[model samples]
Target: MKTDGAEVLSKTVTQDEAAILDAWNVALLEGTSLQSGRIREAELQTQVKTVFGQLRDALASGGLDADAAGFASLRETLADISRSRAIQGFTPTDTANFVFSLKEPIFDALKRMPDGDATALAAGVWAAGKVLDRLGLQTMEVFLASREEVIGRQGQEIAELSTPVVRLWDGILALPLIGTLDSARTGVVMENLLQAIVDEEAEIAIIDITGVPTVDTLVAQHLLKTVAAARLMGADCIVSGIRPQIAQTMVHLGVELNVVSKATLADAFAVALKRTGRKVVRQQASTEGRR
Candidate 1:
């Protein structure tokens, strides 16, 4: 029977699995940060073994296409490795080297084939290169996707953290704005303020933008949206942080906040206090003070 290149290659790798795995490990350590202790020796060994074992099986089954049903398990394994490496802060090149590193060992094994299959060298090397390249590309794709997911989730977390709604009193809440207030931040601002309103049963929300450097038409529109959302939730809103420059800009832009506006967070808070039927009275000196 005439054994094909893939069959011959698979047989060679299976027969020299131990030696091939060692060579693969050496290649990975030399080319990657596996020694920096991101991944333990045992885990690294296991990963190499799993990938090689699957590769051998898939090649034997003529499953070279990465998307083929026969290679599904192998693709899943690669994806898992990619995601793990991505979370470990591995660079894209390092993550891909996990598969590409195996190329040296595999090709070395191919060259050592006995005279009987020596004629299979060219074909075997070509097939092996194509398959490994496909798998390496797959690993890179998954790594990038995992990194994107991590970034998007972290971005949302930071947005929420940046927009904190504090309870100033029993019926009043304050959302102190800082930095630029764009549409995206406005949405975050609105959600946080509304949720706090329900959570604190707040009747008034003071949006203190004293930290806001300037107010543009768009910024004003965003503020109006937030105020509208709060009003719909039965909570009145106060726009604070008005400066000489900002007040002038709003006037020229014909931007009407409609709700009460204050010059500072303290002014907004004081309004919040009185409207909530609360006050801050200073204690007078007693006989102890006189003594």
Candidate 2:
């Protein structure tokens, strides 16, 4: 079942490795990370050698099935490269090209093989191209999966960082929202607010959304969910930062918050302080004492 090209290509790489490496390095360095200095030349050369060695070994064993035992190391090597490239922000095309580019050097080597005839060379080149194509596709798949995982992790980290709970007083906490509120972020807000309530024994929480660009029915619902969750934690939530435009939108949408709301964080804080039986008192200036 082995293609004539596998035997030819394997022998070409095994006997003429130096030539193959030189040719491949020239093509790889022309417009790649090595020339741009993003990746160290030595590191790139090492990865090339590792993959080239594995391909030679796998072809010598007579199979290009990526799942086959002989190709295990090659698969893992490509996977590592794909994941690294993804994390480094390289596109799938850039990552897959690492494997596809090998075809040119390999085809060139096969052409120079003295024992190879036209028919055998044709078959070998065709088979080799197929193998490289499959490997390139594999790298792309891994790159996409890794990229998605990184994006998801970053999203969670951003959500956690955005929803900060600050203790304004012994029993008062403040959460300033700066962006759109969605279900996923609302969950994070609730978790943070509830944890802060438990940790600080807070009786009042002010959710300031002055930085939110817009407020729709869904955003209002997401906010309500957070408020309800905080109330369940034995802490009443006061929504703040209701811009005039946002208030009008909420009124038009008929969104019933059913909770205390204020036009500014300061107003909400003052209300919270009053509800907590505390009020800020300005000391009157003592003219007699100054004189």
**Top lDDT model:** 2
Each candidate: RMSD to true structure? 3.4, 3.3
Name the lDDT value of residue 24 in candidate 1. 90
How many backbone clashes does every candidate have?
0, 1
In candidate 2, clashing pairs total 1
Considering only N, C-alpha and C atoms within 3 Å, which residue pairs clash in candidate 1? Answer: none
How does each model score on lDDT? Answer: 0.85, 0.86
Which segments of candidate 2 are over 4 A away from where they belong?
Answer: 1-3, 67-69, 90-94, 285-291
- How do the residues 15-76 of candidate 2 rate in per-residue lDDT, one tens digit apiece? 98988888888778874656555677888889999999888888889865767888888889
Q: What are the per-residue Cα lDDT tens digits for candidate 1 across 1-291?
A: 554767777787888888889999899878756766788888987888888888878877774576788788899999999999999998898888889988888889888877646558877787788888999999999999999999999988887788899888898888888778888888888888898899999999998887788888888889989999999999999988788898998899898778899888889888888887877865656544431
What lDDT score is found at residue 6 in candidate 1? 74
Residue 136 accuracy (lDDT) in model 1: 95
TM for every model, in the order presented, reads 0.87, 0.88
Q: Give me the overall lDDT of model 2.
A: 0.86
TM-score attained by model 1: 0.87
